[model samples]
Target: MRRMIVLGLGALLFVFPFYYMFIGSLQAEPDTTVTSVLPDPGNLTLGNYAEINEKVNLGTSLLNSGIFTGGVIACTVVFGVLAGYALARLRFRGRGAVFGIVLLVQVVPFQLLLIPLYVLIVRGYGLADSHLGVILPFAINTTAVFVFRQFFLQLPNELFDAAHVDGAGELRVMWSVALPLVRPALLTVVLLTFIGPWNEFLWPFLITKQADMQPLAVSLANYISNVAGRAANPYGALLAGACVLAAPVIGLFIAFQRHFVSTDIGTGVKG
Candidate 1:
Protein backbone atom coordinates (compact mmCIF):
# COMPACT_ATOMS: atom_id res chain seq x y z
CA MET A 1 0.00 0.00 0.00
CA ARG A 2 2.82 2.40 0.91
CA ARG A 3 4.73 1.51 -2.25
CA MET A 4 1.61 2.07 -4.38
CA ILE A 5 1.05 5.43 -2.71
CA VAL A 6 4.69 6.40 -3.28
CA LEU A 7 4.54 5.41 -6.93
CA GLY A 8 1.25 7.22 -7.50
CA LEU A 9 2.66 10.35 -5.88
CA GLY A 10 5.83 10.09 -7.93
CA ALA A 11 3.85 9.64 -11.16
CA LEU A 12 1.71 12.65 -10.36
CA LEU A 13 4.75 14.78 -9.56
CA PHE A 14 6.42 13.76 -12.78
CA VAL A 15 3.33 14.26 -14.94
CA PHE A 16 1.88 17.38 -13.32
CA PRO A 17 4.26 19.92 -14.91
CA PHE A 18 3.60 18.71 -18.44
CA TYR A 19 -0.12 18.58 -17.73
CA TYR A 20 0.03 22.14 -16.45
CA MET A 21 2.08 23.30 -19.43
CA PHE A 22 -0.38 21.66 -21.79
CA ILE A 23 -3.31 23.17 -19.95
CA GLY A 24 -1.71 26.60 -19.93
CA SER A 25 -0.96 26.37 -23.64
CA LEU A 26 -4.62 25.51 -24.27
CA GLN A 27 -5.87 28.50 -22.30
CA ALA A 28 -6.69 31.94 -23.68
CA GLU A 29 -3.80 34.15 -22.65
CA PRO A 30 -4.83 35.20 -19.18
CA ASP A 31 -6.74 38.46 -19.37
CA THR A 32 -7.03 40.83 -16.41
CA THR A 33 -9.58 38.51 -14.81
CA VAL A 34 -8.19 35.08 -15.69
CA THR A 35 -4.75 35.17 -14.15
CA SER A 36 -4.43 31.46 -13.44
CA VAL A 37 -2.52 29.02 -15.68
CA LEU A 38 -5.45 26.65 -15.90
CA PRO A 39 -7.83 27.48 -18.73
CA ASP A 40 -11.62 27.59 -18.74
CA PRO A 41 -12.81 24.57 -20.74
CA GLY A 42 -14.88 26.69 -23.10
CA ASN A 43 -12.05 29.14 -23.89
CA LEU A 44 -9.62 26.50 -25.22
CA THR A 45 -8.13 27.70 -28.49
CA LEU A 46 -5.52 26.92 -31.17
CA GLY A 47 -4.59 30.54 -31.90
CA ASN A 48 -1.17 30.34 -30.24
CA TYR A 49 0.05 27.63 -32.67
CA ALA A 50 -1.37 29.46 -35.67
CA GLU A 51 0.26 32.70 -34.63
CA ILE A 52 3.59 30.88 -34.10
CA ASN A 53 3.59 29.26 -37.54
CA GLU A 54 2.53 32.47 -39.28
CA LYS A 55 5.28 34.45 -37.54
CA VAL A 56 8.18 32.03 -36.97
CA ASN A 57 9.79 29.38 -39.15
CA LEU A 58 9.26 26.53 -36.67
CA GLY A 59 9.65 23.79 -39.31
CA THR A 60 13.11 25.07 -40.21
CA SER A 61 14.10 25.06 -36.55
CA LEU A 62 12.96 21.46 -36.18
CA LEU A 63 14.98 20.46 -39.24
CA ASN A 64 18.10 22.08 -37.86
CA SER A 65 17.52 20.34 -34.55
CA GLY A 66 17.21 16.98 -36.32
CA ILE A 67 20.41 17.55 -38.28
CA PHE A 68 22.34 18.60 -35.20
CA THR A 69 21.08 15.70 -33.10
CA GLY A 70 21.72 13.10 -35.81
CA GLY A 71 25.29 14.31 -36.25
CA VAL A 72 25.93 14.37 -32.52
CA ILE A 73 24.66 10.79 -32.09
CA ALA A 74 26.78 9.54 -34.97
CA CYS A 75 29.93 11.20 -33.72
CA THR A 76 29.40 10.20 -30.10
CA VAL A 77 28.84 6.54 -30.97
CA VAL A 78 31.78 6.18 -33.37
CA PHE A 79 34.34 8.22 -31.48
CA GLY A 80 33.17 7.19 -28.03
CA VAL A 81 33.57 3.47 -28.79
CA LEU A 82 37.01 3.92 -30.38
CA ALA A 83 38.33 6.03 -27.51
CA GLY A 84 36.75 3.78 -24.92
CA TYR A 85 38.20 0.60 -26.46
CA ALA A 86 41.68 2.11 -26.72
CA LEU A 87 41.58 3.04 -23.05
CA ALA A 88 40.28 -0.38 -22.02
CA ARG A 89 42.31 -2.83 -24.14
CA LEU A 90 45.28 -1.16 -25.75
CA ARG A 91 48.62 -0.42 -24.16
CA PHE A 92 51.09 2.26 -25.18
CA ARG A 93 53.41 4.81 -23.59
CA GLY A 94 51.56 7.44 -21.52
CA ARG A 95 48.50 5.18 -21.48
CA GLY A 96 47.86 5.73 -17.77
CA ALA A 97 48.61 9.44 -18.08
CA VAL A 98 46.32 9.74 -21.07
CA PHE A 99 43.48 7.94 -19.31
CA GLY A 100 43.92 10.16 -16.24
CA ILE A 101 43.84 13.28 -18.39
CA VAL A 102 40.74 12.08 -20.24
CA LEU A 103 38.92 11.38 -16.98
CA LEU A 104 40.08 14.73 -15.61
CA VAL A 105 38.79 16.51 -18.68
CA GLN A 106 35.37 14.99 -18.03
CA VAL A 107 35.26 16.81 -14.68
CA VAL A 108 35.32 20.18 -16.47
CA PRO A 109 31.92 21.67 -17.25
CA PHE A 110 30.99 22.13 -20.93
CA GLN A 111 29.74 25.67 -20.13
CA LEU A 112 33.30 26.72 -19.26
CA LEU A 113 34.42 26.06 -22.82
CA LEU A 114 31.57 28.02 -24.35
CA ILE A 115 33.28 31.39 -24.71
CA PRO A 116 36.62 30.06 -25.93
CA LEU A 117 34.88 27.54 -28.19
CA TYR A 118 32.63 30.23 -29.57
CA VAL A 119 35.63 32.43 -30.30
CA LEU A 120 37.33 29.51 -31.99
CA ILE A 121 34.24 28.76 -34.03
CA VAL A 122 33.73 32.39 -35.01
CA ARG A 123 37.36 33.32 -35.71
CA GLY A 124 39.62 30.25 -35.88
CA TYR A 125 37.55 27.98 -38.10
CA GLY A 126 35.54 30.66 -39.86
CA LEU A 127 32.50 28.46 -39.26
CA ALA A 128 30.29 31.07 -37.68
CA ASP A 129 26.67 29.90 -37.28
CA SER A 130 27.39 26.72 -39.20
CA HIS A 131 26.04 23.29 -38.17
CA LEU A 132 29.47 21.68 -38.41
CA GLY A 133 30.77 24.43 -36.14
CA VAL A 134 28.58 23.30 -33.24
CA ILE A 135 28.77 19.58 -34.06
CA LEU A 136 32.57 19.34 -34.24
CA PRO A 137 33.35 20.66 -30.76
CA PHE A 138 30.73 18.50 -29.04
CA ALA A 139 31.80 15.40 -30.97
CA ILE A 140 34.49 14.59 -28.47
CA ASN A 141 32.61 13.98 -25.24
CA THR A 142 34.85 13.05 -22.29
CA THR A 143 31.98 11.56 -20.37
CA ALA A 144 31.06 9.32 -23.26
CA VAL A 145 34.66 8.22 -23.48
CA PHE A 146 34.65 7.34 -19.78
CA VAL A 147 31.32 5.57 -20.06
CA PHE A 148 32.49 3.53 -23.03
CA ARG A 149 35.76 2.76 -21.30
CA GLN A 150 33.99 1.53 -18.17
CA PHE A 151 31.73 -0.67 -20.24
CA PHE A 152 34.61 -1.93 -22.35
CA LEU A 153 36.59 -2.87 -19.25
CA GLN A 154 33.78 -5.13 -18.20
CA LEU A 155 33.95 -7.08 -21.47
CA PRO A 156 35.24 -10.59 -21.14
CA ASN A 157 38.90 -11.14 -22.11
CA GLU A 158 38.12 -14.43 -23.84
CA LEU A 159 36.43 -12.71 -26.72
CA PHE A 160 39.51 -10.64 -27.51
CA ASP A 161 41.76 -13.68 -27.20
CA ALA A 162 39.58 -15.71 -29.56
CA ALA A 163 39.49 -12.88 -32.08
CA HIS A 164 43.28 -12.57 -31.93
CA VAL A 165 43.66 -16.29 -32.56
CA ASP A 166 41.43 -15.97 -35.61
CA GLY A 167 43.78 -13.24 -37.02
CA ALA A 168 41.23 -10.52 -36.44
CA GLY A 169 42.66 -7.00 -36.22
CA GLU A 170 41.50 -4.57 -33.52
CA LEU A 171 39.30 -2.73 -35.99
CA ARG A 172 37.78 -5.97 -37.23
CA VAL A 173 37.24 -7.18 -33.71
CA MET A 174 35.56 -3.91 -32.78
CA TRP A 175 33.29 -4.02 -35.80
CA SER A 176 32.41 -7.70 -35.55
CA VAL A 177 32.66 -8.60 -31.89
CA ALA A 178 32.94 -5.67 -29.49
CA LEU A 179 30.26 -3.47 -31.00
CA PRO A 180 27.64 -6.18 -31.07
CA LEU A 181 28.46 -7.02 -27.48
CA VAL A 182 27.99 -3.46 -26.30
CA ARG A 183 24.72 -2.50 -27.94
CA PRO A 184 23.25 -1.33 -24.66
CA ALA A 185 26.09 1.07 -23.97
CA LEU A 186 25.96 2.28 -27.56
CA LEU A 187 22.23 2.91 -27.22
CA THR A 188 22.83 4.79 -23.99
CA VAL A 189 25.51 6.94 -25.60
CA VAL A 190 23.35 7.59 -28.64
CA LEU A 191 20.39 8.59 -26.49
CA LEU A 192 22.45 10.95 -24.37
CA THR A 193 24.07 12.60 -27.37
CA PHE A 194 20.71 12.93 -29.10
CA ILE A 195 19.12 14.55 -26.04
CA GLY A 196 21.97 17.03 -25.60
CA PRO A 197 21.71 18.27 -29.17
CA TRP A 198 17.90 18.28 -29.28
CA ASN A 199 17.32 20.11 -26.00
CA GLU A 200 20.29 22.47 -26.03
CA PHE A 201 19.18 26.12 -26.03
CA LEU A 202 21.93 28.41 -24.77
CA TRP A 203 24.67 27.27 -27.16
CA PRO A 204 22.38 27.20 -30.16
CA PHE A 205 20.95 30.59 -29.19
CA LEU A 206 24.45 32.02 -28.97
CA ILE A 207 25.89 30.45 -32.10
CA THR A 208 23.00 30.34 -34.54
CA LYS A 209 21.58 33.84 -34.60
CA GLN A 210 19.63 33.38 -37.84
CA ALA A 211 16.08 32.22 -37.26
CA ASP A 212 16.30 29.47 -39.87
CA MET A 213 19.45 28.07 -38.31
CA GLN A 214 17.91 28.14 -34.84
CA PRO A 215 16.81 24.88 -33.15
CA LEU A 216 13.39 23.92 -31.77
CA ALA A 217 14.11 25.40 -28.35
CA VAL A 218 15.09 28.77 -29.81
CA SER A 219 12.21 28.67 -32.26
CA LEU A 220 9.81 27.90 -29.42
CA ALA A 221 10.99 30.98 -27.60
CA ASN A 222 10.44 32.99 -30.75
CA TYR A 223 6.92 31.50 -30.96
CA ILE A 224 6.18 32.70 -27.44
CA SER A 225 7.21 36.26 -28.32
CA ASN A 226 4.98 36.40 -31.40
CA VAL A 227 1.92 34.89 -29.72
CA ALA A 228 2.10 36.95 -26.52
CA GLY A 229 2.88 40.13 -28.42
CA ARG A 230 -0.34 39.88 -30.45
CA ALA A 231 -2.60 38.83 -27.52
CA ALA A 232 -3.61 35.62 -29.32
CA ASN A 233 -5.00 32.57 -27.54
CA PRO A 234 -1.73 30.60 -27.68
CA TYR A 235 -2.94 27.73 -25.56
CA GLY A 236 -3.17 24.83 -28.01
CA ALA A 237 -0.48 25.85 -30.48
CA LEU A 238 2.23 26.40 -27.89
CA LEU A 239 1.30 23.11 -26.27
CA ALA A 240 1.45 21.43 -29.67
CA GLY A 241 4.95 22.73 -30.25
CA ALA A 242 5.99 21.65 -26.79
CA CYS A 243 4.63 18.23 -27.63
CA VAL A 244 6.54 18.28 -30.89
CA LEU A 245 9.76 19.21 -29.15
CA ALA A 246 9.18 16.55 -26.54
CA ALA A 247 7.89 13.80 -28.84
CA PRO A 248 11.21 12.41 -30.08
CA VAL A 249 12.62 12.25 -26.57
CA ILE A 250 9.45 10.71 -25.21
CA GLY A 251 9.35 8.21 -28.06
CA LEU A 252 13.00 7.36 -27.56
CA PHE A 253 12.32 6.68 -23.89
CA ILE A 254 9.34 4.55 -24.77
CA ALA A 255 11.26 2.55 -27.33
CA PHE A 256 14.16 2.05 -24.97
CA GLN A 257 11.53 1.47 -22.27
CA ARG A 258 12.78 -0.98 -19.63
CA HIS A 259 16.32 -0.56 -20.90
CA PHE A 260 16.42 2.95 -19.48
CA VAL A 261 16.18 1.61 -15.95
CA SER A 262 17.29 -1.98 -16.37
CA THR A 263 21.01 -2.62 -15.91
CA ASP A 264 22.42 -4.44 -18.88
CA ILE A 265 25.82 -6.15 -18.94
CA GLY A 266 27.27 -3.48 -21.23
CA THR A 267 26.85 -0.76 -18.63
CA GLY A 268 27.01 -3.10 -15.65
CA VAL A 269 30.26 -1.65 -14.38
CA LYS A 270 31.48 1.84 -13.53
CA GLY A 271 35.09 2.97 -13.31
Candidate 2:
Protein backbone atom coordinates (compact mmCIF):
# COMPACT_ATOMS: atom_id res chain seq x y z
CA MET A 1 0.00 0.00 0.00
CA ARG A 2 0.99 3.65 0.43
CA ARG A 3 2.86 2.90 3.66
CA MET A 4 4.91 0.21 1.94
CA ILE A 5 5.77 2.63 -0.85
CA VAL A 6 6.86 5.25 1.67
CA LEU A 7 9.05 2.74 3.49
CA GLY A 8 10.59 1.65 0.20
CA LEU A 9 11.42 5.25 -0.66
CA GLY A 10 13.05 5.74 2.73
CA ALA A 11 15.14 2.62 2.29
CA LEU A 12 16.20 3.72 -1.16
CA LEU A 13 17.28 7.10 0.16
CA PHE A 14 19.32 5.42 2.88
CA VAL A 15 20.97 2.97 0.45
CA PHE A 16 21.56 5.38 -2.42
CA PRO A 17 24.67 6.95 -0.95
CA PHE A 18 26.41 3.60 -0.47
CA TYR A 19 25.40 2.50 -3.93
CA TYR A 20 26.67 5.79 -5.30
CA MET A 21 29.99 5.36 -3.55
CA PHE A 22 30.47 1.81 -4.81
CA ILE A 23 29.67 2.80 -8.36
CA GLY A 24 31.90 5.84 -8.08
CA SER A 25 34.79 3.66 -6.94
CA LEU A 26 34.42 1.66 -10.14
CA GLN A 27 34.42 4.79 -12.28
CA ALA A 28 37.20 6.55 -14.18
CA GLU A 29 38.10 9.97 -12.83
CA PRO A 30 35.52 12.45 -13.94
CA ASP A 31 36.30 15.92 -15.24
CA THR A 32 35.69 18.66 -12.75
CA THR A 33 33.25 20.39 -15.09
CA VAL A 34 31.24 17.21 -15.69
CA THR A 35 28.42 16.40 -13.27
CA SER A 36 26.58 13.12 -13.14
CA VAL A 37 25.62 11.06 -10.15
CA LEU A 38 25.77 7.85 -12.15
CA PRO A 39 28.89 6.57 -13.89
CA ASP A 40 28.72 5.34 -17.47
CA PRO A 41 29.22 1.58 -17.94
CA GLY A 42 32.00 2.20 -20.44
CA ASN A 43 33.93 4.27 -17.90
CA LEU A 44 33.77 1.67 -15.09
CA THR A 45 37.16 0.19 -14.12
CA LEU A 46 39.03 -1.55 -11.27
CA GLY A 47 42.05 0.74 -11.63
CA ASN A 48 40.95 2.78 -8.61
CA TYR A 49 41.22 -0.25 -6.33
CA ALA A 50 44.76 -0.89 -7.58
CA GLU A 51 45.58 2.77 -7.03
CA ILE A 52 44.57 2.72 -3.35
CA ASN A 53 47.00 -0.11 -2.50
CA GLU A 54 49.88 1.89 -3.95
CA LYS A 55 49.17 4.89 -1.71
CA VAL A 56 48.74 2.69 1.42
CA ASN A 57 49.73 -0.87 2.03
CA LEU A 58 46.18 -2.27 2.27
CA GLY A 59 47.36 -5.77 3.22
CA THR A 60 49.55 -4.57 6.09
CA SER A 61 46.93 -2.11 7.32
CA LEU A 62 44.28 -4.87 7.44
CA LEU A 63 46.62 -7.14 9.40
CA ASN A 64 47.37 -4.34 11.85
CA SER A 65 43.66 -3.60 12.28
CA GLY A 66 42.88 -7.28 12.80
CA ILE A 67 45.55 -7.57 15.47
CA PHE A 68 44.38 -4.42 17.22
CA THR A 69 40.61 -4.96 17.02
CA GLY A 70 40.86 -8.70 17.77
CA GLY A 71 42.97 -8.10 20.87
CA VAL A 72 40.53 -5.52 22.19
CA ILE A 73 37.56 -7.81 21.52
CA ALA A 74 39.19 -10.74 23.32
CA CYS A 75 40.23 -8.69 26.33
CA THR A 76 36.86 -6.97 26.56
CA VAL A 77 34.96 -10.26 26.43
CA VAL A 78 37.06 -11.86 29.18
CA PHE A 79 37.24 -8.90 31.56
CA GLY A 80 33.73 -7.58 30.92
CA VAL A 81 32.22 -10.98 31.73
CA LEU A 82 34.27 -11.37 34.91
CA ALA A 83 33.58 -7.90 36.26
CA GLY A 84 29.92 -8.00 35.26
CA TYR A 85 29.30 -11.42 36.85
CA ALA A 86 31.01 -10.31 40.07
CA LEU A 87 29.04 -7.08 40.21
CA ALA A 88 25.74 -8.86 39.60
CA ARG A 89 26.14 -12.01 41.73
CA LEU A 90 28.93 -11.66 44.30
CA ARG A 91 28.62 -10.14 47.78
CA PHE A 92 31.41 -7.68 48.38
CA ARG A 93 32.18 -4.34 50.04
CA GLY A 94 32.26 -1.29 47.74
CA ARG A 95 30.27 -3.16 45.05
CA GLY A 96 27.99 -0.14 44.63
CA ALA A 97 30.99 2.17 44.50
CA VAL A 98 32.60 0.02 41.81
CA PHE A 99 29.43 -0.07 39.71
CA GLY A 100 29.04 3.68 40.17
CA ILE A 101 32.58 4.22 38.98
CA VAL A 102 31.97 2.05 35.92
CA LEU A 103 28.90 4.16 35.13
CA LEU A 104 30.87 7.37 35.70
CA VAL A 105 33.50 6.25 33.19
CA GLN A 106 30.93 6.27 30.40
CA VAL A 107 30.16 9.92 31.13
CA VAL A 108 33.76 11.04 30.60
CA PRO A 109 34.74 11.88 27.02
CA PHE A 110 37.55 9.78 25.52
CA GLN A 111 39.20 13.03 24.42
CA LEU A 112 39.69 13.88 28.07
CA LEU A 113 41.68 10.69 28.58
CA LEU A 114 43.70 10.99 25.35
CA ILE A 115 46.54 12.97 26.87
CA PRO A 116 47.04 10.61 29.82
CA LEU A 117 46.76 7.53 27.57
CA TYR A 118 49.45 8.96 25.29
CA VAL A 119 51.78 9.67 28.18
CA LEU A 120 51.23 6.30 29.85
CA ILE A 121 51.19 4.01 26.83
CA VAL A 122 53.72 5.88 24.70
CA ARG A 123 56.18 7.56 27.05
CA GLY A 124 55.79 5.94 30.49
CA TYR A 125 55.42 2.36 29.29
CA GLY A 126 57.91 2.72 26.41
CA LEU A 127 55.53 0.74 24.19
CA ALA A 128 55.64 3.17 21.31
CA ASP A 129 55.57 1.72 17.75
CA SER A 130 54.13 -1.57 18.99
CA HIS A 131 50.83 -3.43 18.50
CA LEU A 132 50.45 -3.85 22.26
CA GLY A 133 50.72 -0.10 22.68
CA VAL A 134 48.01 0.51 20.08
CA ILE A 135 45.82 -2.09 21.78
CA LEU A 136 46.57 -1.05 25.38
CA PRO A 137 44.36 2.01 25.71
CA PHE A 138 41.21 0.10 24.65
CA ALA A 139 41.69 -3.25 26.39
CA ILE A 140 38.77 -2.91 28.83
CA ASN A 141 35.55 -1.22 27.84
CA THR A 142 33.52 0.11 30.78
CA THR A 143 30.37 0.28 28.66
CA ALA A 144 30.79 -3.39 27.78
CA VAL A 145 31.15 -4.26 31.46
CA PHE A 146 27.96 -2.38 32.26
CA VAL A 147 26.17 -4.16 29.44
CA PHE A 148 27.28 -7.63 30.61
CA ARG A 149 26.34 -6.75 34.19
CA GLN A 150 22.81 -5.70 33.20
CA PHE A 151 22.34 -8.86 31.16
CA PHE A 152 23.57 -10.97 34.10
CA LEU A 153 21.18 -9.16 36.44
CA GLN A 154 18.23 -10.05 34.20
CA LEU A 155 18.79 -13.84 34.56
CA PRO A 156 16.88 -15.72 37.27
CA ASN A 157 18.62 -16.01 40.65
CA GLU A 158 17.46 -19.64 40.89
CA LEU A 159 19.91 -20.53 38.14
CA PHE A 160 22.84 -19.37 40.28
CA ASP A 161 21.50 -21.13 43.39
CA ALA A 162 21.23 -24.40 41.52
CA ALA A 163 24.79 -24.10 40.26
CA HIS A 164 26.11 -23.19 43.73
CA VAL A 165 24.23 -26.10 45.35
CA ASP A 166 25.93 -28.42 42.86
CA GLY A 167 29.30 -27.25 44.31
CA ALA A 168 30.30 -25.42 41.16
CA GLY A 169 33.11 -22.92 41.65
CA GLU A 170 32.47 -19.30 40.60
CA LEU A 171 34.33 -19.63 37.30
CA ARG A 172 32.57 -22.91 36.58
CA VAL A 173 29.22 -21.32 37.34
CA MET A 174 29.95 -18.36 35.08
CA TRP A 175 31.29 -20.33 32.13
CA SER A 176 28.81 -23.22 32.26
CA VAL A 177 25.63 -21.55 33.50
CA ALA A 178 25.61 -17.78 33.17
CA LEU A 179 27.71 -17.13 30.08
CA PRO A 180 25.62 -19.31 27.79
CA LEU A 181 22.59 -17.11 28.49
CA VAL A 182 24.17 -13.85 27.44
CA ARG A 183 24.99 -14.55 23.77
CA PRO A 184 23.08 -11.45 22.61
CA ALA A 185 25.13 -9.19 24.82
CA LEU A 186 28.32 -10.75 23.49
CA LEU A 187 27.34 -10.07 19.87
CA THR A 188 26.28 -6.51 20.68
CA VAL A 189 29.38 -5.70 22.62
CA VAL A 190 31.58 -7.23 19.94
CA LEU A 191 29.99 -5.15 17.21
CA LEU A 192 29.93 -1.98 19.32
CA THR A 193 33.52 -2.43 20.43
CA PHE A 194 34.57 -3.43 16.93
CA ILE A 195 33.47 -0.08 15.49
CA GLY A 196 35.50 1.94 17.96
CA PRO A 197 38.90 0.35 17.36
CA TRP A 198 38.27 -0.48 13.73
CA ASN A 199 37.52 3.05 12.61
CA GLU A 200 40.01 4.56 15.04
CA PHE A 201 42.57 6.71 13.25
CA LEU A 202 43.79 9.36 15.68
CA TRP A 203 44.95 7.01 18.43
CA PRO A 204 46.80 4.69 16.08
CA PHE A 205 48.33 7.60 14.17
CA LEU A 206 49.46 9.11 17.45
CA ILE A 207 50.81 5.77 18.71
CA THR A 208 53.04 5.00 15.76
CA LYS A 209 54.51 6.92 12.86
CA GLN A 210 55.50 3.76 10.99
CA ALA A 211 53.38 3.12 7.88
CA ASP A 212 53.35 -0.67 8.29
CA MET A 213 51.87 -0.37 11.80
CA GLN A 214 48.97 1.92 10.86
CA PRO A 215 45.43 0.55 10.56
CA LEU A 216 43.23 0.97 7.47
CA ALA A 217 41.54 4.04 8.92
CA VAL A 218 44.77 5.88 9.53
CA SER A 219 46.25 4.96 6.18
CA LEU A 220 43.05 5.78 4.33
CA ALA A 221 42.86 9.08 6.17
CA ASN A 222 46.41 9.89 5.18
CA TYR A 223 45.65 8.90 1.60
CA ILE A 224 42.45 10.88 1.31
CA SER A 225 43.98 13.96 2.87
CA ASN A 226 47.38 14.01 1.22
CA VAL A 227 47.53 11.81 -1.84
CA ALA A 228 44.05 11.17 -3.26
CA GLY A 229 43.68 14.45 -5.13
CA ARG A 230 47.00 13.87 -6.82
CA ALA A 231 45.79 10.67 -8.43
CA ALA A 232 44.51 10.48 -11.98
CA ASN A 233 41.17 9.28 -10.65
CA PRO A 234 41.09 10.96 -7.27
CA TYR A 235 37.40 10.51 -6.43
CA GLY A 236 37.30 6.84 -7.43
CA ALA A 237 40.49 6.07 -5.54
CA LEU A 238 39.19 7.73 -2.38
CA LEU A 239 35.91 5.82 -2.45
CA ALA A 240 37.76 2.58 -3.14
CA GLY A 241 39.78 3.08 0.04
CA ALA A 242 36.57 3.76 1.93
CA CYS A 243 35.06 0.55 0.56
CA VAL A 244 38.05 -1.45 1.74
CA LEU A 245 37.87 0.13 5.22
CA ALA A 246 34.11 -0.50 5.54
CA ALA A 247 33.78 -3.98 3.97
CA PRO A 248 34.80 -6.13 6.95
CA VAL A 249 32.55 -4.37 9.48
CA ILE A 250 29.56 -4.45 7.13
CA GLY A 251 30.21 -8.15 6.39
CA LEU A 252 30.51 -8.96 10.10
CA PHE A 253 27.18 -7.36 10.97
CA ILE A 254 25.48 -9.10 8.07
CA ALA A 255 26.91 -12.44 9.16
CA PHE A 256 25.98 -11.96 12.82
CA GLN A 257 22.68 -10.11 12.43
CA ARG A 258 20.68 -13.34 12.64
CA HIS A 259 22.04 -14.05 16.12
CA PHE A 260 21.15 -10.56 17.36
CA VAL A 261 17.52 -11.58 18.03
CA SER A 262 16.07 -11.34 21.54
CA THR A 263 17.12 -13.78 24.26
CA ASP A 264 14.59 -16.06 25.94
CA ILE A 265 15.57 -15.92 29.61
CA GLY A 266 13.06 -18.57 30.76
CA THR A 267 14.67 -21.17 28.47
CA GLY A 268 17.99 -20.89 30.34
CA VAL A 269 16.47 -22.18 33.60
CA LYS A 270 15.88 -25.92 34.06
CA GLY A 271 13.15 -27.52 36.19
Model 2 stretches with alpha carbons more than 4 Å out: 1-13, 31-35, 257-271
Please, what is the whole-model Cα lDDT of each candidate in the order they appear? 0.74, 0.83
| Per-residue lDDT over 17-73 for candidate 2, one digit per residue giving the tens place of the 0 to 100 score | 887878888888553344546667788889988889888989998999999999988
Highest TM-score: which candidate? 2
lDDT of 1 at 75: 80
Error of 2 at 92 (Å): 1.8
lDDT by residue (1-271, candidate 1, tens digit) is: 9999999999999998777766666655543253454557786766656655656666887789998888877887788789899999898788899899996875677668889988888788887678987677666777778888988899999999999999999889988988888888887777656667788777777677778788888778766766545544555566667877887888887887665544332222211
TM-score of model 1 vs. true structure: 0.84
Separate clash counts for every candidate: 4, 0
Q: Residue 22 lDDT in model 2?
A: 86
- The number of the candidate with the highest lDDT is 2
Candidate 1, which segments miss by more than 4 Å at Cα?
Answer: 1-10, 27-47, 225-227, 234-236, 261-271
Q: What TM-score does each of the candidates earn?
A: 0.84, 0.87
